[model samples]
Target: MTVLQSFPIPRPTTNPYLIMLGEALRRTPGVTVLNFSWKTALFGRYDVYHSHWPEILVGGRTPLRRLTRQALALMILIRLRLTRRPIVRTVHNVERPDGLTARESALLDVIDRQTTMRIRLNSTTRLPDGERFKTIPHGHYRDWFARYEPQEMQDGQIGYVGLIRRYKGVEGLVSAFRETEGRREGLTLRLGGNPSTSQLAASVASLADGDRRIELHLAYLSDAELVEIVTSSELVVLPYRFMHNSGGALAALSLNRPVLVPDNEVNRKLSDEVGSGWVHLFDGELTAESIITALDAAAVRADRPDLSARDWDRAGIEHADVYRAAIDAGHRR
Candidate 1:
């Protein structure tokens, strides 16, 4: 079967998940994959259109451009529908990364209605439409990222890495860190990620205001820098208000660092499934004290689960199943 990705990538440079999955897919026997281009999509023949981030087509820096892109994407959707090809959207987040706007939400509703299949990273991921969605666990980064020896929990380092945005609960992290600073001696907080927007950068910077114990590197860090942060840290926090699944947590665990996350259903499922000393869940209003308690659990993690089941090879096989299922469903339609 031939599969066309919704977005074009000649090579996967950034997202390690994509890199790993693409490599696995390429290795899969009797499977052909094509990088997506609008013109190629129009003329190219394929059995399935698999999209990890369909929002990328519509999302932009400005509202006007975003709307314009959405209009063009709608036309593309219609073209795909006319071609009678199956569309598979991989649900990375239950909501948009930048927060779902009303217009964006409506656009997603259309996509949901038109979609033949929706692939979620985990079983606990909620679906807007239940008829077509299924879960395939996210592959770990152990094979992709540079392997580093795990460091001891010197000074109780608590780290957060990924794009900094309001939805990420950075304010809560800063406040919680400040509140815990007094009781936990030598506990340091380090946050590294490019802020989603310029205004978000300025606002979040103020939260760190001259705190010696807290270090803020609010820019995109290289892989080595990311490794340094994860390797040195005692534990990492997702700190998302709500998330379907997190590659960041997997990255931390791949480097042998435990993770703390909010007690949402998807997160809880990840905790139970990953079941290494990997996850420490927090309940009802995460405050400084709660974070401290979670850290204490991380401090004494003697056994961490080896998440070998979530490798790229397994993900690729699972994804193949989804694509074939979509093809079958399209035939039925």
Candidate 2:
């Protein structure tokens, strides 16, 4: 059997789901993998064409460019339809186009009409055209966790990772870290990721100049550096104001490190379903006092066993099943 997997290039972060999907397909006997571009012409030879990307509707200026691209994509879909080869789309996120113009809405309608199946990461997302959709959670890069070495505790050391965006609640984390800085012995806050130095400094500038516990690594981090930072810390805090599903949180969970997330409904549901006692949810407002209390609790339970084994394998097997089902459905049609 032949399978063509199409993905977008030039993304800053490596997508672990694509990696896992490729690996799982390779492991299946009698299956051949093909990586192709979005504009590639389809010969009538391939058995399946599986596309992975967030569902996007073209908007903004350059309607000509958009039409050209859409024409090529439509040609590929027509080929699949003619050959009866199943076209499966993995929906990472079906983002509404910025400004939500009429043209964008129409383009989305076109895509909904063309695609056959959608695999959703979160179960909450609505289906396209009321068609069949499968829910598969994201997986972790298990190999990256092997390089991590636990760091010696320095009392109140706290760490946060990932892109330091406004919605990420970095300000909350900093305020919480500062609240316990002098009150606890050896209290330190370490911030790492690809945020601009000026932006990061501006966020935490209110802290005293002499505060030694705060360390910031405001640059793109390699896998080794990320693993080291996550493993060494007593607790990894995700204080997200909103989370659909967190890839970073899963990465830390794979390393058996405890994570402190806000007590949102989503986090609460995941914690209960996964039996992950390590995920602590904050109550009341996400004030410095509330976050500090959660962090202290997380510090005590940092050594908890990793709860990732089941979820990781389950996500992998679920994708494998989706691939097989797509293949079978195509053959039947």
Q: Candidate 2 on 1-333: residue-level lDDT in tens?
A: 677777543254756666666766666666666666654445535676676652332432577876765666666766877777777777765464356556546655665665667787766666646687788766665654565665555445566778777667777777667676455566667778775457665665554246677787767777777777777776778877777678777777776666777776667766665554567777644655655666566655434444564354465566566767877876777
- Give the least accurate 10-residue stretch of model 1, judged by summed lDDT: 146-155
Provide the lDDT at 24 for model 2.
65
Q: Identify the runs in model 1 with alpha carbons over 4 angstroms from their true place.
A: 10-13, 59-75, 96-110, 128-130, 147-153
lDDT string for model 1 (1-333, tens) is 999877567453457777677788888876788887866776777888887886787688998889878887787778777777888988876666558688777877677777898887888767764577777778888866655545565558889898887778887888778888668788888889999888888877888887898899989987877888877888887777765577888888887788888887777767677674578887755688877888777766546557877877777878888899899888877
C-alpha RMSD in Å of predicted model 1 compared with the true structure: 2.9
Clashing pairs in 1: 276-305
Query: Which stretches of model 2 miss by more than 4 angstroms?
Result: 8-13, 38-45, 55-68, 97-105, 122-129, 148-154, 196-211, 273-276, 283-285, 299-316, 328-333
Question: Among these predicted structures, which one has the highest TM-score?
Answer: 1
